[model samples]
Target: MTIRAAHFTPEVLLEAPRRSEATPNSKGSLALFSVSTYSFSEHKRQSELRVLDISRNESKLVTDSEDASNPKFLDDNLITVLESKDGATNVLIGDVNDFKKTNYTAGTIDGSVDDWKIKDVGKGKYLIAIAASTQPDGTLYNSEKAKKPVTTGRIYNSTFVRHWDTWVTANKNSIWVGTLSKDSKTSKFALGHFENKLKDSGLESPIPPFGGAGDFDITDTNLAFVAKDPKLNPAFNTKQNLYVIKLDNGSSPKKIDIPGFEGATSNPNFSPDGKKLAFLSMVQNGYEADKNQIFLLDVEQSDPPKGLFTTPDNKGTWDRSPSSITWSNDQKNLYVTAEENARVKLFSIPLAANSTNSSFPKAVFDEGSVASTTFLDSGLFISSSSLIDNSAYHLVPSSGAPKLLSSSSRSGSSFGLSRSQVSEIHFPGAKPGTTIQAWLIKPSFFDDSKKYPLAYLVHGGPQGAWEDSWSTRWNPAVFAEQGYVVVTPNPTGSTGFGQELTDAIGGEWGGLPYQDLVNGFDYVEKNLSYVDTDRAVALGASYGGYMMNWIQGNDLGRKFKALVTHDGVFSIPGQLGTEEIYFPNREFGGPFWENKDAWNKWDPAQKTENWATPHLIIHSEKDFRLTIAEGLAAFNVLQEKGVESQFLTFPDENHWVLKPENSLLWHTVVLDFINRKVGLKAYSEQSETAKALKESALSG
Candidate 1:
């Protein structure tokens, strides 16, 4: 059979619009968002600040800066913008009238700003909480310095000499308070003494490699931030405790003592009255992915923070982790966006006395995943997106339904490429009485009369779910555009389901979760007449990559014509030795020496003897989570077995292919490998546009 190649091009796949930093004003009448436009030819990203009127459902340009972010409403008449250009970052305050008029010029705050918050400290004085990175001696760490070493020679004293994508530096993040004068004649802003030193004598806040603005909260008199105690080993310990730094006396930050939450605490949000602090805490230490429980700290009380759900009098329960929390106007309720099943929904928890409702976190909105929520007098303004849509602002009234307030240029209606039609499929679970949900995305130009191949995409985290949300990487639409049906399933271990479901795969990585995937495929093949089962391909990254490797070594190898694994785990033991050891130990039930059999049972390297599927391996040299060695070992095994296989490595990339040029190449290579393996014409022969894009990406 002479198979024809698909007509989709790399440019079409790489040109999707990006949106981030969606923030709503205090009144909730206005919302600001950053929209990024990527140019593959130029290999650069240009971002603009756009403000939306929630009441009018209209949006207007706010800034012309290509790198504007963290747009926050400082007051009714002013907003703050974090502008980054030429390696320098600064905070700019823009007039609301000027922003509405599309005038980009604004007053600048002299400093490299990472995060900032404005609080009225009384008597015409304003306190600004600024989180910026600086050298040990209180000097700004510029981009040039970050690119070059502090010293001409290389020296290391700590284990984190390098992290996920960047080398470690002595420059540490700290909270600095600045005073803003209210008098119009002398309107001045001056940086004051550092309120909290994130890194002091080898101690740091928010923890390295991940934490940021979400790790801290500010009040008129006090500031609370998350940090690991210096006494503990920074390399292995993940316990992050909340510490409060008093602004009045500038005392040393004191760690709040939480009885059972030894794991990690983050996202500190202070109530309107400033008497209570709400944060997210994990019960088990070292297990980063452990369920995050909401905790409330009464500042007046000296005792530890109380777990909202684990209180002795109230057995309040929430199955999912709460994120991006905000206090209600009256400070009687806390609103948060949390994952439930395949969608991230808004949930509210009441913080009133004598409220014993266990199911207090009532769902406020149901459609699409809410990334963030801001409460205003009018209603709740949200930045939301789904599998078929990009992020946009939506305002949900307290008494009425949600209304679209802002429109994204990259929405399904405006997307240049053929958009995919997404639908959820439910099938009997691999376990008793359990139901699994899988998303089926069909090409917009789908013709049921002609069969189409299936691109079965698996998610990472093993604990992570393939949520109904937009993704720049491993997008289902990219596959659908190639005339293939994309199937994304939430197996046994996937989150957003429940703690029971999420914890099930901890020690049984390849057990029920693998079966759930297999069952999902079986259900689709039996029910969907348009699916070309014979031409199917399986692909995944990280934990999903581990599953891809597992598939090749099991009976499932015969089901798919080809397989692709990116940064997958080839050997559990190897990963334990190379990657972060604590997580592996916790997830796999102890160290390799103690649980040799448990580690060996699911080791993909051990089952290589049964492998026969054609494989494509993709890995990055800097992928610390799953080292490049895992990919190399899998590719080596494939070659030794005389299997048709290819390997692609990215030297500058980390666990995920993030660079625009590299991401374009990744899509091209993976698509080309699948085409060639499925008996279709090669990607080079399919479209000249694809060939040119690939060549340009490779050469540049």
Candidate 2:
């Protein structure tokens, strides 16, 4: 709750979680999340969530240092996560690569609960957990802790309890449910929830989950669930219960319905010497289209309850549903993760118990439109955004270069896909022949005998595309760790060079992407001879703040210097009444009273008194899309027409910035306003001009 400001202000990025979050520590069908080496664009909402072992993949800051999500294993010698020292949350455990921690418990709880389930029973002598406690209809619930709990309850509510997943359990007193989240919050992906384990703490549904399955996944045998209570999907109401909850230790707990199995179930798994159980049902007779099918069922052949199961028929296809299903620790490789062709892939299926119509096909990894994955022997994990450099990798396969994992390396794109050693310029257009591709990053610490200090940057969906997400409150790694080189250009209405270079920057905002961002500063000063064509600096945010208001009224570049701008909108009809989702009534596909010469030739208030340059801007009134009244009317017309400019604005924070200590106070307010207007610095190398932007710059 403390925010400060000095020079050209707008700083507040402190909320450190930076990459390596892999997440899942509990729940079932194998789950654990910490693969991160740090990528960014906040893991496209935790993509496909698969890679279960890379932190103690054994030891190397595995757990105990603290901060873990839902990490569980138990049978492989225990892991369990969820810690917090003084703030008080509990369930800690150790040794799986959580090197050490014993068992502790106390409580304060009130974070967003993930999932965890154990119930081992026999030998470790039966363990038990279920998760999400706080019941009585609100704070959240689904309890059952075994030795010291007995059974606690609370089904759903608290802005829809993080989706819901317990999967399968059988000890701390019975459990199973589904849909494990598919995007920020979709709520009960499929269906199944039937509880009753009460000793006086919580839980009492007798087949609830909005009365069915919610999203579905029931294969339990702790005494119920062979399959029937299922119903929901009026396009996702999600209720379709499939019974079989028999656990009656001392009374009441029954629901064994299985008539021709009525559909739903998912990724069930067992067959590794546990006697066949394999699952994935779906079916749906055009009934809102669903196809899944892979089923097996042998559960030790006790044929009595109307025994009869065999459908046998499938190659594979799913316009949607069947996003995951694994099993191959000797179960003969099954692996699924499907959504096929239109995004989300990875197939490989082979068990041949009789071989239906065919089963020999193995595709395994796709992510075409990016998002739908898991085939990891160690490299097909997917949670994407580098739509190709717009940044966020973590791919792994041969491990050559895929772990950008994201904490805020932020890219997979507000620009292009991800991957950038940096290079590509090609330009000719407006006559005879045209090519233009323009790209650059050169400063992971570039050093051709050392020169540095550049900073072009520019990307704000002016149709957005720099082939990677370019960061800027001065970030290209805080101007390469306080030195500066940046350069990101995909100009001429960017969008990976497709669809007419993004409908030529829809509404032709600021002419030819403002000459492809001033011809990417003359193609990084004629192919980066080490940069410094005399202290360059232009930066951007939101249509690159309308090309820094069209580069101080078209003088473009003499290699002058300094200029920042975030939340920079300047005034498209005063930014259509402070934006949010309806983006200036469609970001400028029209409006401002139906196009006033494309809003006076893509207006920056038709050139703010020809901008004079030494700019800074950086706003935030929690800008959901673009607002801060166009950087407070260019800081009240650069402090009522004297010009030199400075604005800052941030504090109840927004418009991106989940906090990493306000991203190191937004790189110390754009490197202390480019070290007093384009002097560029941090250490400032005894300013001979900041010793050539600090020895070829680059450090992060």
Candidate 3:
């Protein structure tokens, strides 16, 4: 199949097949993945399951039903998938060659399941674990008829009244454990009664909003999971603890304690033998962005399995924070993904028991951001993406270079884009001897003699760095296609660089990081002759949104012709509406009252006298993280001050515009706003932007 060359616009990006992380089968000879794409002609999204043959480098459709998802290998030739049956989730078993040809029900659950796992114990019995919502009585909670008060009013005596977009209720996201056995009479797998692992513990496993299968892991006889501490206030604490329980016995969970560590713990990984457990740990309390260190535990499979704490024998302290952990096939080494120099790279760490000579992890794969990885007998299966590429699967052998297996796009030429169009620039930072990196994307049709307007995008997580990855939201390629020189800087506080740089932004919201961005913009304007800063427009969301407001009130505001802030903070003192109070508490040294001076110093509301730029304010009604009030307040100030500004609100969206239709609208309006301010054609009006840009390209 060939994809026609076209402009990488929002509509095109939305329509592009969104692929999930590919899971390799037990033999590693085949992989399973699902793809979802929005169909403009059908006016709905379509989903399908596909099987990829590793050796042949070919793919075949397994099922095209929208209800089919989460395909996994029950064995080499058999596969297990979950499908919706009468509003409840049920597992189905089928042959890999033709799933529907021999499909049959393997097990059924009473309610909706977010994630499910199966581990073969022995004989005909298997351990089944699922993460789902449960009521106070430890019963599966059905979301369709979720228990809610009849009254319209909501009362809250405790904090966490709401998280992200949903209000806190009696129902908790918990893990359920059960047994599945095969009956010789019918030769069918039957699901036994499931018991809530967190029952009466007052804790939620796989914490809401983002947690899924990664929150917990199960072995044949034991289970491990991460849960927020019940003793602390959920609103202002980041103290998620690790717990382990026996799967065969009705036993209570045992919390693993780290004497000096008070921060959060996550990503519990058990060795192949299930005797050693590894998890990532942060040392600082309330600070969620701290460097994560790998902590090992020795598990003795006694009656109640005793867990003894163990630490890595270090030659030195590592600076990078690992996002995920995976044990080696031999359990002699560990592979992890961590950010380094604006890229998520794979690192290998040698594991030794009670040894004090283990060196730091070494980088194995250093190109592109690795989204997910699976262990293979011959090598590692990596799914990664970059600025010009949507998704690509590669097999990195232990001794050789990575071999590309498949890519979401047929080729770069098929999309009218190439890796050459993207480059990185490093400039001097605000502090002496410091440097910052940024990604620079040129238009598809580029001429070295012609200058293009600048689109400066600041990333949200103040701690988050601009990675060399593809994103449907805030895509630099989309902006570059609009005839702009897009430069995204990784200023101070950006992650993947080092812990020092990441922790530098605390209490200095508008200080060194702002200067780093200013210096980056300055470098682009003065050093890059093809970029025209005179018609530049800056945009950001979340903390990046906050930076736009900060720039609006500082000297940097005069550098850009226009600014866009999405769910940004207008006033530090007016942030009580946010559900995560711990964010400000750690960033500002304490709560508002305790650190009034520090909060006031960086408050954009205090410098409203300097507001004089054309701005676009985008906020969502359900943005409980920064709250909608913050956006409204910024717009009000801009309006009252006679600044040229427009307000765009999505009543149905949360912090992000996720719905396909809503995302398209967001991109359209954002492009229109920036284009209009920079004297470029509107997105809807110019359907030939790609062709025009292509014609302007320099000869290869």
Candidate 4:
């Protein structure tokens, strides 16, 4: 069976530019943002800087290059941006008036800068904090030479052999401070010799692979950054601690001794007065996603840091995880963004006299999911969006409705669907008095009397929720474009509902969450006449993938015509050894040996005899979180049981398909598999390009 390929073409759904990394100037009159444009034909990403005038609501292009990001306002007239050129990344300082550019890392070899801070001191002296990657000897690690070993067949002496998506290299991130000196000839500023702050202690700033500007902060006399010691167990002991280095007098960095909270500390921010430091701390060791609370430390006093406002229960739960903290000019209030009831809202908390006990976070912006926010003299400038809307900038006042400043219309319009097409649906769960929220996205060309095929997508994080936020991956609009009525539900294990609902799936991954999904499907089928339940397909990744595996083994296998599992766990006991050991152990109650019954209760490997559903198994080799072994085992079971299935593997990808070309291939394969299994052949014709792609996929 074949369908017209025009509806599923990449050009129809892939032309949106991504906007991020918004930074407002001191006066808040103008803001700079990075906009990324993708070219599917070329398979490349090009980034450009857009300067938005807050008052006028106008944007002007600043720089257009492949490596332009992290734009910061050094001063009212000076702007700094990171640019990559000739296979090296460097800091570029530009004047706002004339846009004259100057390369700060001119003499440095193959240098790269990640996060940097510029602070003005007295008498033309400036303290600059830079999170830069260089070799152990303060030189650039030549990529061409690093690819080849210095000595053939050298002995290995590294702890982290590889991480996330890249192999661990000798290039490590270090914090450096450089003084600005004006060149007499050109009247442009250049950094005078940079001093390595982390020279005495061999540690990397922002830890590696994941940390960013949130992991560090800077003041006039001191710089506080997050780093993990390589000597510790790299696998299970990835705890980042806060270390403060004095800018002057050459003092070694000192680890801040915060009593009772010794796990991971990040998002360091200094108060306006610089007397106190505010940061986020997680209490449990080895568990990265443990509940994080805001902590305040008095720089002058040696007392332990005070635990400020936390969730209502005061326990390390999943209720609140505050991030993107910003301090008010008066130092009396701190603003943060946290997940609440299926959306991320901006919240503000007052700092009391004692600093120990503070008021609960008051919701500042409650409408949409805020991704990034910046403070201005007029109001708060935020980038927010709903499930049906694309990311846009809004100016939110102290007490008024948020005004839209700029919208990402390029991608939003590319979907060819209006906001009215997507609506929220709530249904009662299997458990009494419990309500499950699901988003129903109707196809653009919909009729009330017509029945449409259903696409049920499950979100990954057992603690994750299908919030009213836009997603580039697993987009409901894409599924809707393929003539499927998409339904995404936030079940019992999902966050953003409440602590009780999220905690209900801690030890019962296959229990309440599974029932909530089934009940959700049943509700849609029974109540919604437009949904064709008999022609439904279920797809999921991570925990959702685990549920797919569970459903295939359980009685729910007969409900859906086909299933798609991406990087899902098949055997709990087998995954216990290969997967990341910390969170799974806690979520499954205990070790597999100690809690064998709990581990095997929902183990899909134990019920392979009941697996009859046709499935599409997807896995990546670098997915260290779930590992490729899980996908292989599930595929092996399906083959042995003679159930129709196909296995797709990406040798270069990680837990998520990130590369542009890889993502295109993933979507193509997934859509083709679903269409073939669900017998979707309305057009009964195929384009030559579509046939060529199908043949290529099969031949490869």
Candidate of highest TM-score: 3
The window of 10 residues in a row where model 4 has the poorest summed lDDT is 1-10
Model 4 per-residue lDDT at 661: 60
Candidate 2 lDDT, tens digit per residue, 237-263? 222322223243434334323334344
lDDT of all predictions: 0.76, 0.46, 0.84, 0.75
- lDDT string, candidate 4, 1-700, tens digits: 0122234334333446667746778787777887776776566778778788877877777878667767777777577677766655566777654453543442332556677787777555566777777677865544544556576443447444556666666678887777765566765666667777887487788677877777778888788888875466555564778887777779988888666665778888888677788898876666665567888888777777777754444564336877668887778888888877778899888877765556778888876589887776677888887765556788788778878776665324544556767788898875688899988888778898999889999988888877767766667777787788899999987776765676677788888888988889889889899999999999999999998999999887788889999999888887654534656676777777898888888888888889999999999998877878999999999999999898888898888987666666677778877877667742213334334444565742
Give the range of the ten consecutive residues with the poorest summed lDDT in model 1.
1-10
Residue 224 displacement (Å), model 4: 1.4
Clashing pairs in 3: 445-693
Question: After superposition, which runs of candidate 1 have C-alpha atoms over 4 Å from their true positions?
Answer: 1-10, 85-88, 99-111, 122-124, 137-140, 143-160, 186-202, 311-316, 354-359, 409-411, 416-420, 577-579, 679-689, 696-700
Q: Candidates sorted by lDDT, descending order?
A: 3, 1, 4, 2
TM-score of each: 0.91, 0.26, 0.95, 0.90
Query: What's the CA RMSD for each of the models?
Result: 4.2, 25.1, 4.7, 3.9
User: Which ranges in model 3 have alpha carbons more than 4 Å from their true place?
Assistant: 145-148, 301-316, 353-357, 687-700
Enumerate clash totals for all models, in the order shown.
0, 84, 1, 0
The lDDT of model 2 is 0.46
List, residue by residue over 388-407, the lDDT tens digit for candidate 1: 66666777787878887765
lDDT of 4: 0.75
Better of 2 and 4 by TM-score: 4
